[model samples]
Target chain A: MNCLLCNCQLSMRLCITELFLPIDHQRETVCDACRARFSAYHLSKQCCPGCGHPLNGELLCSECQAWKNNYGQFLHHRPLFHYNEAMAEYMSLYKFQGLYQLRMVFQHVVQMAIKQEEYDLLVPIPVSPTTLRTRGFNQVEGFLEGMQFHQLLTTIDDHKARQSARTRQERLVSQQPFQLNNNVRVTGQHILLVDDVYTTGRTLYHAADLLWQAGCQRVKTLSLAR
Target chain B: MQKTDFYGRRVLLNAEEAQQIRIPNLEIMPAVKKNGDRIYCYRCGQTSSCDTSHLPNNQYYCPVCFNLGRSSSLACYGHLAEPNHFTLPTSILTWSGQLSPLQKRVSQAIDQGMTNHQRQLLWAVTGAGKTEMIFAGIAHALARRERIAIASPRVDVCLELFPRLQAAFANTPIALLHGRTPEPYQYRQLTICTTHQLLRFYHAFDNLIVDEVDSFPYAANQALLFATNNAVKKTGGILFMTATPGRTLEQQIHRHQLHVHYLPLRYHGHLLPQIKINLAPRWRKNMERGLLPLTLIRSIKATLSAQHQCLLFIPHIDDLPLVEQVLYRQLTNSRFTTVYAADPQRIEKVQAMRDGDYDFLITTSILERGVTFPEIDVYVLGADDSVFSSSALVQIAGRAGRAVTRPTGRVIFWVSALSRSVNDARRQISLMNRKGRCLQRELSSL
Candidate 1:
């Protein structure tokens, strides 16, 4: 097998325990060198409790503080990886370039990260109909392949600009683009929203706001990158 | 996009762009085809299982040629029939450079091949002025109003060849295309692009010349070969130029399927520099311990004393820092630097080397070809490594003895153990040199 990112041949050596046990293990899609490029956030690091943003012994980041003032509560966001150059490149290829096979590169890691969270419904942020028609897949849902997830929200705006193309201020003040699916039961239920990246937490906030209006008891968020 | 953009080209377009082009001559085709459980890309001609490349709603995109554009089922290809629209220019060949008698013969053969629309391969040695020789054929094709494109596997080679081709055909408009070219595609009589760009073309060129046919990505890639075959018209001519032909080309030559021409001597009429092998066992271990082999260091010193720059080729980029540390410690007064593909200042460092800023450079296989430095001796630290293919070794040796002032430079390979590629490289060089010697003797008798 070759690394999905770099296309280098991957050499697999079975350990003594594995040789005896003979259990089928999921093969790695990326080589160790390419895998090392992505840096996972350590839970013990000093970070904002709300958004997982690195902080100096602060309870919440300034962005989260602003969110708390607007909404009754800030989102409990857990990002798996830092938004480094490698992650940016990965996102560009996986999302913009539409190399669908690249979704497999982070599938296992994202699945494992989501397994640690407790939620009644695992909801993924939806793409605009235009994006769904053009890009052919919701990038957030692509990471959650082969897992049970609820498509509880749908984008109502047809001309919603991509978050990547908008400036930070434009993204912050942009109107909510998402709406709850008709006849979805989320009342008094814990909801977990999934997204590909947490840029300014605006996208997830929009989705969470809809779920909150739908009478969800609580809302949490997870992303592949922050 | 204009009608001219789709002329002789197959560009993937969305529904909006497809609706804009209303020409009756436009041939629209699906970007990808589905058969059972497989998806076949029409552009690259590769079949993939639907599971790996599928989109939502039973749509599939080709991941192989994604760099060109996303060729999913949602997109369609726009192709306009090639009208061979070219204005005959008063003067096509602006290059006044003269080819030698042997090179002139090969140039005439190429011109004839192009005229007859035949497939041919020109096996010319390094520094044989292959570009100058092809000017006559390209000019002939242009005069005949035949569309032409010259492609290479490496972008660096295409970038280096574009300006030279523009200068040669000064009266003709030329388009340059690559994965990174920002300008939109235009209809031009002549085009120079990388081989990957050929996937965007549909029987575009009547005469296609592929340089460095044995180079990376082109030699080992089947999709590129399919694209090359698809880019040319059914009756069009193709000329493959390379110093070393790989196994596939060699088999074609043996089967008499490919017409072959050989220019065994350099333009300066000198035999290639012979490779001298030096066994340096445990060199990697010693390098980690911060020590280079005594013989390698002495050779570098000798080449420096002779006022020639040195090119130290290592097997991998990971070994560079180790070799660099030892070089700095041993030759503290000598000016040197390291370079690799990922180095941000790669182009600048190569320019600096050309400006005589450094006495030597430690580099990976990225600099194995398409670079010429005068008065330089080459030393391959690990010639037996699997990374150094036979052709790569030959190209690395070709880097030496390029300039007329110093037609004979040293090429040494420090190998821990002898390998087949090493033997093949040595044998290939000697075979060409012998052929060159025979040509010289025949010319002298004449």
Candidate 2:
């Protein structure tokens, strides 16, 4: 089967993207694509196992994640696929198009794009109840349909963008960030942050920023489509 | 928005979601109220807004969500590449345009694999013209805008292959990547590279081919296999072309587990080239004192009379120059060139021979691999050369008969001593020839 995530074949075990599919390639278990996309991809290695970064071999953005103690851990929120016009169109029918059945494909491609990683938990990015009622579901939550689920952390606070409108330079200058639920704590745990479409990557950046602040060992992001 | 205009295919999910995503199929996450904090778990429908909650360490769903599970199985290279992109073509090597048994079987396998998008392995023998068989599949994938990469061990082989493939599909954007070439800047659909160069790519091409699959660099290193996997695009086609498949591959093929092709003969009604052993051990060792090896000296003169350029392979650089000097001395006015390691003039010398600058060329193992001349009589002084690998010797001999005049040559191996390698080379040549003839007969019958 074509993994919606990494687009790798679905032969063996279920990759992270497999959870969204109805029938996998082998027609036995899930596939590797989904597992890779949703698994704790960021925590797979010590960031030291290889001379290069541990997050993703393709994006060797983190050369020093191991030595640095804590500065909002991710090297850079560099999403794998290009969220171009074509991808955006796929997302329109996929993200906002209300074709919920398409979530399985998202999982497949994402899984194909990424591979297996070691992480503490797969945390679906949380949304507000009011927002969920209007949208009918948390975008990422829909991907976890057939996946094993968890209740690790809550999305208690709605983070704000640093500024309303600004040039690229201005936005880079403003730098306001996401705030998580302080009542709950997630310290020194590998965090695989699941989301839907990776548009600006700012939202995932803000969310992961909150995660690292809580002392999480690592934070990674995966979306149905990018 | 796909510029060329692709219809929006609203792709659907398969069974993976039910198995790997979440078994029970609850796409909606329930909000819960925990100590005044609102949280949710998509699996159990438990949220901070709900009354019940589970501990963080409690085993509820699979590990990915909780980040506490295994891959469930070891993922192989076939899974990383697209299965549907592989299509072995029925070879049209000679003008008759008939697919050999090996070509037919391999093409069927690749076609099947590409259509199903599944991983597969294809095994065959040397001189099988395995490259020609995959051209149809590769061309198809390229037409579809899918990416492809054909990789092998030696650059010389790439030198021979690239031109042939380029001719097959005119005016396509093809890239031959190595340390010298720049990486594709926004546009490189099909590529060729040495395995060492593969480490530079990561999930890029849609179809991956490891030519001479049993050859070094690719077979000896697990990391190379990993690198090939990394360079290929997700769900791409993977094809391995090899002659002497290792025991592991042989077992798979014997069990009918791998996709296989077996083209044993040369195209165009040509017979497998012939080999001859020159029993001149004593003559070679004692010829150092300004004396010419009678057997070699005679063969060279007779070969010249036949209007054939001769390739005399001596094991050492010292002997190559010595042979050139001796041949010059023996024939008085005859012209000859020597090509060996560190011969800064190697290319000039090779070109000189090609341009017919000299009637003979004495070379080292450098010419033992690629670069074929149609009608060359080849002689190996140290056919027992440890430096001469089995594949290398076979290929050097293959350079003979490349010209239609004599679809073969007088391959004389002058050995000071007999070694296992010499026997191996002889055995290999014989077996390959027999297989080639057998296949040719079969192909003709068909």
The candidate scoring highest on lDDT is: 1
Listed for each candidate, the true contacts retained, as a fraction, are: 0.72, 0.00
Taken over the whole model, the C-alpha lDDT of each candidate is 0.90, 0.56
Worst 10 residues of 1 chain B by lDDT: B15-24
* Candidate 2 residue-wise lDDT at B22: 32
Best by DockQ: 1
Docking class of 1: medium
Q: Which stretches of candidate 1 lie over 4 Å from their true place?
A: A22-24, A43-46, A56-59, A157-159, B15-21, B35-37, B279-309, B324-338, B343-360
lDDT per residue (tens digit) for residues B136-249 in model 2 = 677666656666778887676676778877777555656786545555322355677787556545456667787876555455455566666666656666777765555556
Estimated TM-score for each candidate: 0.92, 0.47
lDDT of 1 by residue, B1-446 (tens): 67788887898888777888777778888999998999999999999888789986788999888988899998899998889977888988899888788989999999999999889999999988899889999988898999999999989899999899888888888999898899877889899999999998888889999999989989989899999999999888899999988778878999998999889998888899999999999888888888888999999999998888999999998898889888888888999999999999999999999999999999999999878998899999989999998999999999999999999999999999999989988988898889889999998899
Q: After superposition, how far is residue A154 of candidate 2 from its true place, in Å?
A: 47
